[model samples]
Target chain A: MAAARARSEERRAAIVRAALEVIAERGYRGASLGAVAERVGLTQQGLLHYFPTKEALLIAVLEERDQWDTGGGAREGWRLDLLGSLVEYNAMRPGIVQTFSALLGESVTEDHPAREFFTRRYAQVRAEMAAVLRAEYGDRLPGGLTPEQAAPLVAAVMDGLQYQWLLDPDAVDMPAAFRDFLRLLGAR
Target chain B: MAAARARSEERRAAIVRAALEVIAERGYRGASLGAVAERVGLTQQGLLHYFPTKEALLIAVLEERDQWDTGGGAREGWRLDLLGSLVEYNAMRPGIVQTFSALLGESVTEDHPAREFFTRRYAQVRAEMAAVLRAEYGDRLPGGLTPEQAAPLVAAVMDGLQYQWLLDPDAVDMPAAFRDFLRLLGAR
Candidate 1:
């Protein structure tokens, strides 16, 4: 029974990875369940047994991406300085960034399935960023704004830079630009 | 002859508008030419008389958006302070922004028709931004980076803030966040 459960878990992981690849190649709207199933060598019926719905598969892909980024919740302790390193790390993985950016871009349309996920995620991200800023600058940053006020911009730069870099990696050095932003944030 | 040409131009403009609405509702990948044609009261073959291909229609939609933003090439003299105003202007037009963001997000995938369009557009935008920075700050910004080095970040912040604002308009004030970014740029 234990071995059977482990095998099922392994199959689920493989399916999620395949879903990411399909979503990366085609935006989530363009990625079909059949394509993902084929990549993982599962029939559409078999894939449905695991994900239940395309939306469920998409959520799993997104959650799996976050897990990879946070190393299973290590994001709870991220410092402001570490963001630059994170950007640098992201530059090494274009496929994941492409998938995330595609989903984010597509989710803004009316009634998109991922809309709620990104909306809630940004709010939580803003709150976490505010905490990071507050921890570093003590209420107000050097520019005389509170951490809560500045957090969204910080998040915006990170996300925005990814879009630009993904479009043209050679021209836009993601890590260097992020460090430059950190300098701007630190300026008095 | 003059009346016939004028009518053709009007019909083409109507087709582009319908394409924008459809692309805004469904991403470029998910948006079908037939749907756009139907919205504009044309058969798909009739739509072909104007656009010839889906890619041509997509480009027309993109160019139309640029024309709207630049007011027919008045982007030539935009000052740094005007960027904040521009952000405010963008907030007034959610559908246009959503359409552009959706295309941009989907364009990053391999073989996307808009990929080359966006890639070239960013390079041009970066150069334009660099010129804007140089005009405002001379050889270097207050933060000591050259205009060329700083241009990408400025563009990133604007594009990035838009994504965040689109996801949760109430949580993020695009205009306010942009002004804060300007302040950060001007900080000594």
Candidate 2:
């Protein structure tokens, strides 16, 4: 039973990695199940053993990256560490942002898997980010900037910078950008 | 000759409006040239006469919106007004934040028209936003931040907020968020 579970986990990770590579090279629309399966050394049917549909697979890929980025929910105690970790994660998986946003823009339908993924992701990201801000500010962000107010701005900055980074990594000096934005938030 | 020019401009505007509506209703992948032409009471050939391809048409729509939003470059005055104008512009067309991101994500090829559009757009946006920072700080932002240091962060904050707005309009109070961020910049 342990061996079976381990193999399942390994297979899932392999699939997610393959999906990221495919998404990077071909984007969301251009990626195909056949190509992903071939990359993973699995037949389409074999790949389907893990993910039932492409939508399911896309959501899994997102969740997988989220976990991979977070390193298994290990961000419970620190705020600066969390922000720094996420910046690194985003910087590393830049293409995922494009795939994620494109899928989200199309996922307006309630039934689309990415809709729920994004909704949940936003909630989690926002909540955690807000928690970090509160920790740093300790009840004073000044200029009437509450944890509630600042959290979404933080998310927006990350999302918006991802757009900038998508076109030209050189366009924005990302780490410097993040640090400055953070400083602005902390200013009294 | 003047009448012909006026008619052509009107037709172009109509086509762009129709395209926006079509893309809004149908996902980008599902929005076709025929659907857009049909929406605007024109034949596909007529649409093609104005925009030779879907990509060309999409980029035109983005540029038109950009031009309309910026008041045709009338915000070329001082820095604060320019930044304030940007805040107001984003407040009005919050949806375009995601719409433009979605479009760019789908059209990532180096040859795609958005490649150039965003490249130039970033240059202009960066310069204007940097100018705003320079106006307030001159060289130093409170808390040891510099305009050269702060410009990219301001740009990132603007970009970041737009993405959050797409998922949840209420997530960030657009004008208020910008106001606070700007205040923080001025404080620096």
* Top model number, DockQ: 1
Per-prediction DockQ scores?
0.51, 0.37
Tens-place lDDT per residue, model 2, A1-188, is 99999999999989989988998787766667888999999999999999888888888888877777667783435566457557766777656777775566555432456666776677677788767778777665754577767776777777666666767788676666776677667666
Tens-digit lDDT track of model 1 for B66-127: 77777777454669998889899988877667767877888887788888888988888888
Instruction: Report the lDDT tens digits of candidate 2 across residue range B34-128.
Output: 99999999999989999998878878878877777667873334566456666766677544555665665555433456677776777677777
Off by over 4 Å in 1: A1-11, A17-41, A53-55, B1-10, B17-41, B52-55, B74-76
Q: How many backbone clashes can be found in candidate 1?
A: 0
Clashing pairs in 1: none
Given candidate 2, what's the lDDT at residue A12? 90
Per-model TM-score versus the true fold = 0.86, 0.82
Question: For residues A1-188, what per-residue lDDT tens digits would candidate 1 score against the true structure?
Answer: 99999999999999999988876576555568999999999999999999887877877888898787777874547789988888998898777688788888878877888889999888888888888888888987886677877888888888888888988999999899989888777777
lDDT of 1 at B50: 95
What's the lDDT for residue A125 in model 2?
79
